[model samples]
Target: MSFQDWEITFEERTEELVEDYGDSWRLKFDDNIEPDNPAQDWFQYIRGAFARFQCSKCKKTWPSRRVLVVFHFRLDGRKRKGTVEARRFRQECRRCQEAKMEEPQFDSDNIEVLLEKLVERIRMRCYRETLDGIQRDFRPVGRSEGPHESSHCEACLKGVCRKAE
Candidate 1:
């Protein structure tokens, strides 16, 4: 059979693999679930994503309302020590705007600690389902990967994050 007959969908591809291997394909092969295009991994990550959120006071959950949170962390790649800063924008909460002390607050002297918290919030805020459940390793692109053209995104290095400061 010509390859053209195989539909370009995941289910179709999986079926094609199974037919060729007598259902042992799954055991013999690792999952090729990543996006067909490699560039999609990084490009999509730089773009915004979302996740489920539950309101404490209303006792309800909703996925409609969302926020854009821009973030970066600065630290030595080898030592892995640095502070992370994030810009989170959300319209003032109806309940929070009305009451001054309705919400709790805390502070931290250690930047690393705060950065960890920010990263965690981003994970919860960004819906994994929306991003295809793939996490980019953020390693430096090799010569074979793509053009080494000069650009703002050239290096995903630690100091690069500090530039946002």
Candidate 2:
């Protein structure tokens, strides 16, 4: 028969073999096996997989039991000052006492890297928005004399102050 016909026959035979063997024989199925109901979308699967956890203290529901860990890194070239710290906190429910513990799988280094990546993404977006706003408001006014310089904007300054408090 044709290649397509042979392939279909082989698939049917494999299913039959699996059924005949039952639990006694362990067959390693190929990863490419299609789901029975292929019409199910990814969103439906994700929604089903994502279980909600209720906080015992406040009775508030969370998407999952995982807690968010925030890492702060500061560097001041002029003063030669640099520091890195990690803080773990859970989104508080109606009542504040119940806090979910973060997954133990994430090590300090992993958390730090995640924070670094997040900061990079935020910085990129902030710079893009600032450039757009500047282009809209003021003319080039001729390029500056030295290398490019950057300073903490008001939002970043406020965030730093809040964290310190």
Candidate 3:
């Protein structure tokens, strides 16, 4: 998938989450997920999706299906309120001699797919739904060549992203 406006995708996914989970859950995108939340049932989920990125200086474009995304959420059953925070990993242009870590650009389809899995995870974790019969397909729209470079990935640098076991 090519680049699309992340803000719009986030808003759309949030609306879907609200529609499915009702008004009790509040989802937000943050720079980082705070670890000091007082919620006892706080949980975390990590997902990967294919995204396109371009070097700001060199204009070099590349595709990566290893772009990692992290979600932290908690459901306060007593108050019937839930909170979720998300953060997406970034990558630097490998071709550039000196490049900044660029934000991943996700197309509408990829974003939808990613958020769909997120909703499923929420149902399994917060809603206590079993994952036995859930569909686990999270394959991206296109294939990315070469192996993922942890050296250029922001999440990898911070030890937030991990290889699939």
lDDT of 2 by residue, 31-140 (tens): 22222222222100000011133455656544422223333333333453323233333232334553543222232333333433433432333222222222111112
Off by over 4 Å in 3: 1-22, 34-40, 131-143
Model 1 lDDT tens row, 1-165: 111221122133334324532331111111221222222212111212222233455533322112223444322324422222333222222333242111111112212232333334333343122223333321211122322212211122111221222
| TM-scores, one per candidate | 0.24, 0.23, 0.75
- Sequence-dependent TM-score of model 2: 0.23
RMSD of 1: 20.7
Report the number of backbone clashes for model 3: 0
Q: lDDT values of the candidates? A: 0.26, 0.29, 0.71
Supply the TM-score for candidate 3: 0.75
Give me the candidate number with maximum lDDT: 3
lDDT of 3 by residue, 1-165 (tens): 332354455456557546766646655667666333423557877777778888999998888877887778777777767677777788999888879999888767777777767766777887777766445455464667688788888877887666563
Shift of residue 56 alpha carbon in model 2, Å: 17
